[model samples]
Target: MAWTEAKLIAEAILEGFERHFRLFRETTAGAQARFEQADWPAVQVAARERIDFYDTRVGETVALLRREFHLRDPSDTLWRRVKVEYMRLLPQINQPELAETFYNSVFCRLFDRHYYNNSYIFVWPLISTEHLEAEVPIFRPYYPARDGFARVIARILRDAGFERRFRDMRRDIRCLLLAIRSRFPANRAIQQNFQIAVLCAPFFRNKGAYIIGKAINGADQIPFVVPILNDPEQGLYVDTLLTGVEDISNVFSFSRAYFMVDTEAPAAVVDFLRPLMPRKGKAELYTAIGFQKFGKAEFYRDFIKHLRYSSDEFMIAPGIRGMVMCVFTLPSFPYVFKIIKDRFPPPKEMTREQVKEKYQLVKMHDRVGRMADSWEYSHVAFPLDRFSPALLELLDAECAGSLERVGDQLIIKHLYIERRLSPLNLYLHSADDDDIRHAIGEYGDAIKQLAAANIFPGDFLFKNFGVTRHGRVVFYDYDELCYLTECNFRDIPEAPYPEMELSEETWYTAGPNDVFPEEFATFLLTDPRIRKVFRARHRELLDPDWWRARQASIRAGHLEDVFPYPVERRFRKDREEFPRRYPHLADG
Candidate 1:
C-alpha cells in the first residue's frame, strides 16, 4: 500500500534515528546490551557523577519524554523535545559561549559519526581555503527535516523575541549573562527579545495582558541596538570583516575570485559583476591606464623597485573584509607577484592605508575591462619581449650565439648549437654537448642563484634546467616555484622520488636525532653525466652543505615564521615569548 504523508514523514524520522543509534553502537564498541539494560535516568545520573564533558543530559531528556509523553521509539521523537529542553536550559550554563560551542560541536560530531567513517579524519582547512560551494551551503545528514528545524529555530530567535530580553535583563542575572556569553553577533537584536521569552515563558505563557505590560514597562533601554544585515543582495560588509585580519587574499572571497587574478577566469565573472557598477564608459580607459602604468617598458627599468619599499612594501587592497589585503609587486627580470602584508598597520600612517585602498580601485577598474584576472592590478603575465633582451645580454657574454623571445611567454625555439654556454643550458643538460660535465657545473650554479632568490624549478629533474642560446643557465616553468625557505637542496637523494613511493604526508621521514645533512651527491649521481660534474665541483655544492645548512638556518628562527603579510603590531607579545620558548635559536 502507498504510504500517507504522515507515514512518509515518520519513516524519514525513524531512519534518521536508526542511523544515530547505529553510530552510537559503533562508537561504544557494540555495547548495545549495556545501554538497553540500564535505566536511562540513572545513565544521566552517572554521567553527572563528575562535571566532566558528556553526562546523561541526553539520556535524561530522552527518559523524561518517554515517561511523560507515553512515547515509544523515543530516539525518533527526542530531537525536537531536546531542542526545546536545550532552549529551556540556556539560562543555567556557566559560560554560555563555551556551552553553545560545546552544543554545536557535539551536534556536528554526533552527526558526522553517523555519516563518515572514523578511519578518515577530517582535515582542518588552512587560511584562505574555499568555503562551502554556492549550491550547497549546509548539509543535513539525517534527512532534510532536522536541517529545516534548526534554521526555523534560528529564524524564530531572530525575528520576534530578542528586544524584550535585553531590556529586562536586571530581573534575572543568570539569563542576562547567558545572553551576553552566547555573543551571537549575527542575530543579536532578535535573540535578545527571545531571551526574555525564554525567561518568562514557563510561568507567563498563559498570563494575561498584565504580565506582558509589566515586562514592557520594565524595559528602559531601546531594543535592536545591534545592526545586522540579513540581505544577500547587499553583499557582505567588506570593511567590518577585514578591519583586523591582515591575510585577506587567501580568504574565501579572494580565492573564489581567483579566476579574477588568474589567466583563466570565466567571462561571466566579469560580465555579471559589470551591471552592478554605476559608471560604464571608463571600462576601456581603465585597461589603457594599467597598460601604460606598469607597461613592458616601465617594468624593465624598475625591476627591483618593490625592494625600495620593502619596509613599507605591503598593499592593503580591498577584499572580502574591511581590512585590506597585503600585496607585494616585483618588476624583477622574470617578474613576480608576492603577497606581503603587515597584519597591523600603524594607525598614524593614513597614507599607507590610502595606497592599499588604491588596489581595490585597480580591481574595480580591471573588473570592467574583463582583464581583471591578469591585468596589472593582479600582476600581468611576464612580458617575454622585454625579458628576452636582458636575459640574452647576460647569456651571450658566455656564448657564440644569442636568444630571442617568442610571443609573451618564454619558450625555446632556436635549439641548434649543442655546446653553446647559454643560460638555458641546464634545461638541455641531457642534450649532447662538448664538455658536458663543465656545462652541468655552470647550469647548477645558475640554478643555485635562482633558488636563493626564492625561485626553484617546478620539476627538479636534471632536464628541466637548460642553457639559453646565450650560454647562460635559466629556469623557465615557474608554475610550482616554491618559496626558497620551503626547498631542501643538499639532500637530493637518488632514491625513487618520494611522491612515487608514498603519499605526500607519509613520504618525508625526519629523524628526531638527525642533524641536517647535505646529500646533493645522491642527486648529482642520479645520472652519469651529472655525476661527473658533481665529482668535479664536489666542494661548492657539498662542502658547506648549502641546501641543508641554509634550510636549517631558515627553519631555525623567525625567518620561517614570516607570514605573507607584514608583521602585526599585536605580535610583540609573541616576539617576547619566542626567545624564552626557543632559547637555543633565540639569537637567530
Candidate 2:
C-alpha cells in the first residue's frame, strides 16, 4: 500500500511537468507568426507570459496533492520512496532534467528546508544529459564545395523557412560573402571537407530572426550569425553577419530576453551550441533558449561542484554599500548573493515588499541589454566555515529576519544570485582618460535603451550601475525602478527672482513621479572631467523636452531597435556601410 501511494505521487508530478512542457512548446511555436506579421507588442507580451507558466503549473500540482492526501508534510520514509519512483519514470522523458526540477519544486514546497538534498530532492540530475541527442537532427549540413559558396548561402536562408521574402537577396548574399571572405585565414590550405552547418529553425527575438551556425574548413571553423530583419516597407533583409565568438556571445547576452526556438531535445541543442560559445555554461545556454527552471537546476549542480574545488571565503562585495540590501560573494565564484535588509536607513522610504516587486518587474519586462537578470532562491544554505568573519557579522546585523543558523550551516530564507560586475563608480575612479570617455558613452547608451523599453531607473546615481567585462554599462539596482510611462518628465519651475534661485528651500511643488532631468548633472557628474565628456556626447539626456518626446513615442507603441553589435559592425547604416565603418575594414 505504501509503495503504491508513493508511485501515485511521483506519477502526478511527472504528469504536471508534461502539461507545462506541452504548453511551453505551443507558446514558443507562435513566435514565427508574431515575427512574420511584425507584431512586436505581441512578442513582448508573449515573452512575459511564458515566464509565469511554470509557477502556475506547480501550484496546481501542489494543490492536488494536498486535497488527495491532506499532506502538509509527509514522513521521510514515504517521501524517499517517491524519489525512487520518480527516477524510474525519467528514462523515457524528453526533458528529464526539466522534469527533475519540477519534481524538486513540488517536493520542496511541501517538505521542510532541512530535507532539501539528494534524499528528498534532486540535488543532482538523475539522468545523464551528456549523451542526449534529438530524435531528429537539430542542424542541417550544406557542402559549399558541391553547391558553390554563393548558392550555399542562398540555400541556408531558404532552408530557414522564413515566411517573408528577402528584399534584395543578391545584394545581401554579396555582403555576407564579403564578410566571410574577410574572416578566412590567409594560408591557402583549403580542405575538401569545407561546409556550412546551420540550425534548421530560426532563433526569434523582439523584431529579428537569427540564423545560427558555423563555417568550417578541415582544421579551422568559425561560428556565424545572420540577423534577418523585416523592414515592413522594404520586406526582409540581412542586417549584418556576426562571425567568431565575441560577436556571437554579445547576441546571446545575459541582459537580453530569451530567444524562442523550437527544439524537442534542448540538451542536444545546448550540446551543439557549446563549442560556438565555449565561455557560456550549459545553465546560461538553457536559460537563453527559455528553459529557466532547468537552468536553475543546472546552476545549483555547477555551484556544488565549484564549492568542492575552490577554497575561498564569502566576502562583502567591494563598493559603496547598498541602502536596502546586504550582498556577498565567494572570492573564487563569479556570482554574488543579495538579501534585503531587515531595516532601511534614513531617506530610504519603501517596504521590503515594494523592493521585491521591483525585482519581479525587471524579471518580466524586457531588459533591453541594460538590466542584469538575477536568479531568485529561497532557503538556500552554505557552510558556516566558508564565511569570512566580517561578512558573517554584517549578515547578522542586517539580515536577521531573512537568515537562520541551522547546526553549522547558515541558511538564507530569500535571496537573489546574479553575475558580479565592477561597480561603475569604482571603475571610473581609476580609469584613464580614454577609458572614462568610453564608459561615459556606454552609461548614456544604457539609459537611452532602457527608456525606450519603458523602464525608468528612478535613481541615476553612478553607484546604481556597473560595468561588464565587455565595457558596457548595465543597471543592476531596482529598488526605485519603475516604468518610463509612469514618470512625469518636467522642467524645474522658474524662480520669481534671482535670490530665489539661490535659495536652499523648495521653490516649487513636486509630485512623487515627477523627474527633472536638468538637475542630473549637478549631483551625478560632479567630477569636471566626467562632466565635460558626458555633456559633449549626451547633451540630449539633460533636456526635459527630449525625455517627453521619448515618453510619447513609447506611449504610441513605437518599439525601438537596440542592436546587439556596434554601428561599425552593420552592413549598412545610412551613408556608412561595413568595411568603410571600420578603420581596419576600409581597405577590404
Candidate 3:
C-alpha cells in the first residue's frame, strides 16, 4: 500500500509507541514482582533496566526518523503524536509512579532536542501558594528542568510576535501618562494591561494550557514561585493574577510550591513580577542582618581579639600569583573561608604587563562564578561584609599584604567560602595503602566528568585538588580554569640534541594558552607511589590522543551523562558489584 508523507509519519510514531509499550510492560512486570517480594535492590535494578531500554529505543526511533524522513526539528508533529500515544499508555501501566518516570524521561528527551538547539521557548507561570498545592500532587520539583521550562516559554513568546505587541502596547500614546507614572502605583496599571494583552492573545493563551499541562504531567515538578511580598495588599493582587488564568489554574492548584538572562528572558507576563524580586546578594544580606540582630556582643568582641592576635592565623597555602587570598577556619564557623584582597600588592620589580596579567587572573575568578556548578568546583561566593566584626578583623589581619582598606567595608578581591574537606591531597602522602588505591580510582572518574563538562583545570597540582569527605577528589582552585576545547592538545616536538633535552626551558616556543596533555602526569604526579597508581589506573589522561578525541566528541555536541549523586544512588546494571569493589566508600 502506497503511503503519503503524513501517513508514513503517523505509522512510524505508532510503531515507536508499540515498541515502547512492550518494553514498558516487560520492565514493569519484573519490577512489580520484585516490589511484591520487598526486594528494593531488585526493584531499583529493574527500574534502571526499564530506563535504559526506553532510552535506547527512543534514541533508535529518533535516528530512524532522521534517516528515513529527514526529520530534524523536535517541534515537528511527529513528537506531538508520539506524546499523545504515550499518554494513552500511561494509565495502562501497572505502577503509576513508574509511568510518571517513563513519561519524564521521554518528555525530557523530546524537549531537550529543541531546547539545546535554541528552537523552543518556555515560560514560567508564578502561581499562588494555594494553587501550587492543588496543581502539584507530588512534591518533587527539579529546579534545572523548571528553569529550562521557563526559558522555553520565554522563547516561544518572543518567537510568536507577542513581544512586539507587548512593547508597543506598553509604550502606546494612550498609556503614555500611565507609563511615565509606572514608577509609582501607575506601575500596576501598566502591568495589568500587559497581562490582559497576554490573556487575550490567542497564541499565548492557547499555548499556555499546553505548557502548563506539560509541566504538570511531564515530570513531578513545579515552577518555583516568586517570594511573597511584604505588603499584604500587593501580595494578594500578584497572587490572584498568577492563578487567575482559567486554563493553567488546575496544574498549579494541585501542588504547593542571571547572567544567562540575555539568552533566556522570562515571558512578559512573568516579567511584570520583576519589581518584587529580592536583591541578588541574599547571602550577604542575611548574614549581615543575623550578626547585627542576633549575635552576642561578647562573642563578637572575643572573635575580634582572636582574629587580631591568634598565632594560628596564618596563610593556609602560598598563592601562585603572590596575591593574598588564603583559607582560614574559625571555631565559630564549621567551613573554611578564603579571603581575597581588592588588589595584588605588586612586586617591587614586576613589569606593568605582568601586573596586568595578575589582575586579570584575579578577575577571572569572578567570571567563573557564572559557569555551571559541578562537584569539582566551588558553588557560592559572598562579600566580606557578610561576616561579623571578628571575622572581618581576622580577614584584615590575615590578608594584610593582600588587603586594601576601604571605608567601613574593606575592599577585597573576591571572598570564597567553601566546605572544608580532608586536608590530604590526592597524592595520598598521609593516607593508608587502601585509601591510596581508592583515591586514585576516584580521581580518575572525577577528571573524566570535569573534562566532559568542557572545563580544564589549567593547573594540575596535587595541592589544587583535595580528597573530599567521601574520598572524592575535587578541584577547588579556579585561577587556572580554561575551557577544554580552547586548549591545543598535541605531542611535544622531538628535541634536536641530547643537550637540548636536558635544558630547563622548552626547546620549542610555547604560546601562553598552549597545553600539552601528554605532560600532565609528569607535572602533577611527582610522588613515585602516586605516579605508579595513576599510571596503572588513569594512563589515558596522560595521552594527547585521548584528550583530542574527547574534545572532538564534545565539539560534535555529544554530552555524556554526569550524575551528582554517588554510584549507589545511580541505577547501574551491576548494583551488587559496587559494594564489593569499594566496601568502605560504597555506603556514602
Best by TM-score: 2
Looking at candidate 2, what is the lDDT of residue 145?
Answer: 80
Runs of candidate 2 with Cα error greater than 4 angstroms are 70-73, 185-188, 573-588
The sequence of per-residue lDDT tens digits that candidate 2 reaches over residues 1-588 is 878999998999999999999999999999988988899999999999999999999999998888887463555478889889999999887788899999999988777876787878889887887666546588999998898878898899899998878887866777777776666655767688888889888899888899999888887768999999898887888988998898898888888888999987788888878899998999999998898888887887899899899888999999999999999999898898999999999889999999999999998889888999888889888888999999999999999999889999888999999989999999999999999999999999999999999999999998999998788899999998999989999998888888988878868888899999998988988999899999998999999999999999998999999888886777775224544544453432
lDDT of 1: 0.30
**Which has the higher lDDT value, candidate number 2 or candidate number 3?**
2
Give the alpha carbon lDDT tens digit for every residue of 416-490 in model 3: 444455544624667777888788777776677678766777767666666644455766555556678889887
| Candidate 1 least-lDDT 10 residues | 202-211
Worst 10 residues of 2 by lDDT: 574-583
Model 1 residue 194 distance off true place after TM-score fit, in angstroms:
93
What is the per-residue lDDT of model 1 for residues 284-374, given as tens digits with 9 covering 90 to 100? 2122212121122223224335343333221211111112222122222222232212342434233434534333332322111111122
Instruction: Predict model 2's lDDT versus the native.
Output: 0.88
lDDT rank order? 2, 3, 1
**If both were scored by lDDT, which would come out higher, candidate 1 or candidate 2?**
2
**Please, what is the whole-model Cα lDDT of each candidate in the order they appear?**
0.30, 0.88, 0.41
Model 2 steric clash total: 0
